[model samples]
Target: MLGELEMVKAVLSGSRRTVVLTGAGISVESGVPTFRGRDGSWKNYRPEDLARPDAFEARPELVWEFYNWRRESLRESEPNAAHLALAEMERKKNNFLLITQNVDGLHCRAGSRKIMEMHGSLWQIKCTKCTHAREDFSPLPPMPECPVCGHLLRPGVVWFGEPLIPGVLRVAIDEINKSDVFLAVETSSLAQPAASFYQLAKDHGAVTVEINREPTPISGFMDFALHGKASDILPELMAGLSE
Candidate 1:
């Protein structure tokens, strides 16, 4: 049997249509905490609870408080080598696409241009009343209002009960359908929609690859599985590709 590196290299060779999906596990190396793991609690509140639309409507200030803290925490952390390597792959591949479930925006920071953020972003905010939105990381105070309509400002993200952004899922699906190789990086493959992507790609006759700390729910279905930290594995894979 080929080792993980050789397998990934072999899979990637001659592949012009590739899609990489990332999750919180990839961002944890940059000091950002995983949402469902160790950094799961904040002031006695679960992130899932606070990240809901009902919760935000109940207390927008409280929601902002948590988001602001999270934003500030990640503001200083730089993208790791894995991030840079992925960005390099994007620069080199003509038909490469990156789909990330992380809200931290590290993929963008790492310079991956063709990206789909499935979970929305921490640095983005929109008005409660209108649709006006822009990238703003300023600390929001009590009753922070929208600039356009003077309404409350909320983090631009897919809340617990909300649907994804209008066109985002379609883009991801389209990419997966057309990709010859689909890499599921650092995600548990348990989350809905995103969890279904690799399987969707496989059904469409694409080679599905899994790179994570452990075997995920979809591991059994993947054509190639590599169990390791993305920080360590991704760079090595990229190196092999370049060689």
Candidate 2:
């Protein structure tokens, strides 16, 4: 098998246009619970039900309760070393982009400058009427009202049935299309559209790499597969580039 350092060197020497895609798995190291895990449940509701538009419309209070609890859980969380390593790596690269499926705001906290959040952020809220959005860390009431238009405020997130923000998807696609080095870091490669990026990048003649604790759907197609935690693997990858 090729050594991890060899993989890192190969990635770095491969291209200047690099794109890194991150998912919930990466945040696991920072103590964030996966949405499907045991603690992800609130009351009798499944996580999927709570994140749907119909649920929020029916019982905004209950949905807000889950969100408020999540905020509390996320309040003290810090970015793991993997997130930091990605930020630092981007700094040294000429053209790089970080596309993430997380709403925890950890990538922003880690100082990543060029990022396309595929999902909206938990720290933000959007008005159901107008197109107003802003960071809101305030306590969630049973039904929060949009400060600008007095309309119902929804969590600024791409819920289960919602489409990704068009602009954000465009950027992610463009970055992936142009990248010569594409890293799927801690993602399951199962989220649709985003999941297809590994293939898209490969089709565009990019070197596709997968770094995950276990094999994902596209593992067999990746040019390089590193089975491990990104928290440990990413730093080693960076060190290999420097060596």
Global Cα RMSD, each model: 1.5, 1.7
Q: What TM-score does structure 1 among the candidates reach? A: 0.95
Clashes of each: 0, 0
Best by TM-score: 1
lDDT of each: 0.86, 0.86
Give the Å shift of residue 123 in candidate 2.
Answer: 0.5
List model 1 lDDT by residue over 76-115, tens digit each: 8889877888898887678999999988888899998898
* Candidate 2 lDDT over residue span 48-67, tens digit each: 99999999889888888888
Please identify model 1 stretches exceeding 4 Å from their true place.
240-243
Question: Which pairs clash inside model 2?
Answer: none
Worst 10 residues of 2 by lDDT: 1-10
Clashing pairs in 1: none
